[model samples]
Target: MGKLKSYQKQFQTLLDKGIDNAEIRHKRMVTRPFDFAEKLEKEAKSYSFKSVRQAHNQYAKSLYSSLRTLNERANGYAADLIARIDKEAAAAGAKSGNSKQPAKKTSTRRSTTAKKTASSQSSRGTASTSTASA
Candidate 1:
């Protein structure tokens, strides 16, 4: 046994209300950052930037857009690869992902023979078991 942990009632109440870990962190991230306009202006000037914070804002938007574009490209590539694989598989005689190859006529005949043999063996087993038990 371990010592019982205690907490503030409000913390417990928040837990009971179904707030999760990421939700708490997301709430924190979404909250306003410190207003560092003066510092930002100085830093931007030191780095030979014009219109303080303008470059940063543009960079953020550009990066975000590029990331979305990359994701779309990736999605398109995946779709293309899947189509190629499907075409290759069809060329190799596989019908669908789930469907197995249709059995050859000769194989179907052999399978039926195997099933009949199994059934006969099972019947023999039952007969022998009954004779021994009797």
Candidate 2:
């Protein structure tokens, strides 16, 4: 139990940190190109046409590189989070003596069938009572 709690705390911390880092990275990834574009637009009048085109091309390449980097980092973060969750879940299951195999899932179809039968029986009873009164 204590070990489970420790894992839980560690998972939470990692999740929080991951979220913060992702948010920061996402903001930079989203905003940097726009900021650069704005700067380019501002400086466009001072530079010749060729230089402006070159700058735009460079910006596009950098933006693509950054996007790729961000994607890789996000994937890494997701993998880390999944690993932490699996570790925590395994610890919890072990503590509960369920680590040997997955738990059996109860069938919802049985419950739905039972409910339909119950509703049909109740409706029949009501109909019979109404006929008797009539």
Candidate 3:
């Protein structure tokens, strides 16, 4: 938190807001765990333990997906900040005539899991986490 630039400050605020929203949403989603547990218990006994476990896993996945997305958004912002800082440092060095090396191209390659998570979240209509355009 040492002398953050304007954009970095904005990004930090966005990240904090997004994370807080995600946490609140998750809390709302899980406020009645006993209800969910009773609902599952009321289901047909034919539901094997494995099946119930799988169902629980799916529910957990949905519950945690928003948190994961928030983390990824923060990581993306951090990466962008690093790139900006590197670019500014390079410009300063060039101005001082000490280094002639060009800044490395920023690769936009994304993680496969991130793409899948984003697409799945989009399909589920939950991609309004404001990863960009904050």
Candidate 4:
């Protein structure tokens, strides 16, 4: 009801017009949860024999439960969601776009190991070539 201070005039106008569009419906939908939350907070401060944090936590839990009853919870959202999924899939060794994801200043030790492995392979190849010719 505290949050409703802004909308008292608007609600009155709607009552007079008798039109219920998404805007009016949406306002009611949003305000209802807030009103429920405020009531819960007041009850926590008044009736409960508990610590402030404990009462506050209970209030939050109740508020979330009320909100869940109000709205449709869903799986995913927009283009950013798709892009994030693609990044995670690529990280799990699935192929993604060629555009590189910048990694931080990596371990030089790994690069050194890679260089050593390449040099060892080249030396082995050279030895094999000479042995074959001989």
Candidate 5:
């Protein structure tokens, strides 16, 4: 269980780092180039590219950031679920261990006494019924 927790933490950390790296790469490779191109187009007074690349880049970055946050939240949820499962498994294991002992057998003498008592009670009931009928 401890190992599982450790692994979950490590995996979450890795995912966080991966998300950060991806954001950095996206800023460097996509947003920065689009910004530069938008500037160049504005300076050159070229209306040929009417695609609104800068606005698209901005929207894309906003969406990407949201996705990154959502991914991190998902990782957190997964970690919580793993922890919960581990706790339940440990509890079940403990219950099973305690219950795994062999059940105690009833003493033969006690069983014999119980049988005798039952027979006597039945005989008395029959005798009472006979007396009532009489």
Candidate 6:
């Protein structure tokens, strides 16, 4: 169980790092300054024609796809880990022996206290009668 917990924590850390990396890469790719020096060169015409906005969009799409893949992988890993943990727990429970049998049901015998109380109340006649509903 301890090992399983450790594995789960490690998986969570990996997922967190993946998310952070994706965010950092996305920010870096999208926020870069446009290169004005490339405009003067004839050979840079094809690349220069592509606007920063278009480049940013492309990078964003790529990042989104990669992040989605990462998330899917993480989900699969987490699921497998949970399943393994459950299997281990079930095996442990089985090994400890099935001593958890249902408790014996004792018969609920009615007591004669109600009858005794009623007889005593009757003997107290007038007091009991005075309190009775009309």
Per-model TM values vs. the true structure: 0.33, 0.39, 0.33, 0.22, 0.36, 0.38
What lDDT does the true structure give each of the candidates? 0.72, 0.84, 0.81, 0.71, 0.81, 0.74
Candidate number with greatest TM-score: 2
Error of 3 at 86 (Å): 0.4
Model 6 lDDT on a 0 to 1 scale: 0.74
Q: Which window of ten consecutive residues has the lowest lDDT sum in model 1?
A: 1-10
Task: Tell me how candidate 3 scores on lDDT.
Answer: 0.81
Clashing pairs for predicted structure model 3, backbone only: none
For candidate 2, the 10 contiguous residues with the lowest summed lDDT are: 125-134
Residues 2-105 of candidate 6: C-alpha lDDT, one tens digit per residue: 99999999999999999999999987876644344444464556565558568889999999999999999999999999999999988888898854676555
lDDT of 2 by residue, 21-65 (tens): 999999989898999999978977788989879989999999999
TM-score of 6: 0.38
Model 4 alpha-carbon miss at residue 125, Å: 31
Q: Per the 3 Å backbone cut-off, how many clashing residue pairs does candidate 4 have?
A: 0
- Model 5 lDDT tens row, 1-134: 99999999999999999999999988889987899898987876754345567767889999999999999999999999999999998899898885456555667666776666666766777545543333
Question: Candidate 3 lDDT, tens digit per residue, 1-134?
Answer: 56568779989999999999999999898879967887867885768989889989999998899889999999999999999999999999989989666655443334455566677778988766722322
Mark the regions of model 2 whose C-alpha exceeds 4 Å error after superposition: 1-48, 99-134
Candidate 4 per-residue lDDT, tens place, 1-134, comes to 86697598788987777756766888988998999999989877776465777868999999999787655333334556888988897776645455566675466766776666666766777545543333
Comparing 1 with 6 on lDDT, the higher-scoring candidate is: 6
Worst 10 residues of 3 by lDDT: 104-113
TM-score between candidate 4 and the true structure? 0.22
Alpha-carbon runs more than 4 Å astray in model 3: 1-55, 100-134
| Candidate 4: pairs in clash | none
The true-structure Cα RMSD of candidate 4 reads: 17.4
Q: For residues 21-133, what per-residue lDDT tens digits would candidate 1 score against the true structure? A: 76887777766453466666666566754554687799999999999999999999999999999898876765445657676799888777766666676677754543343
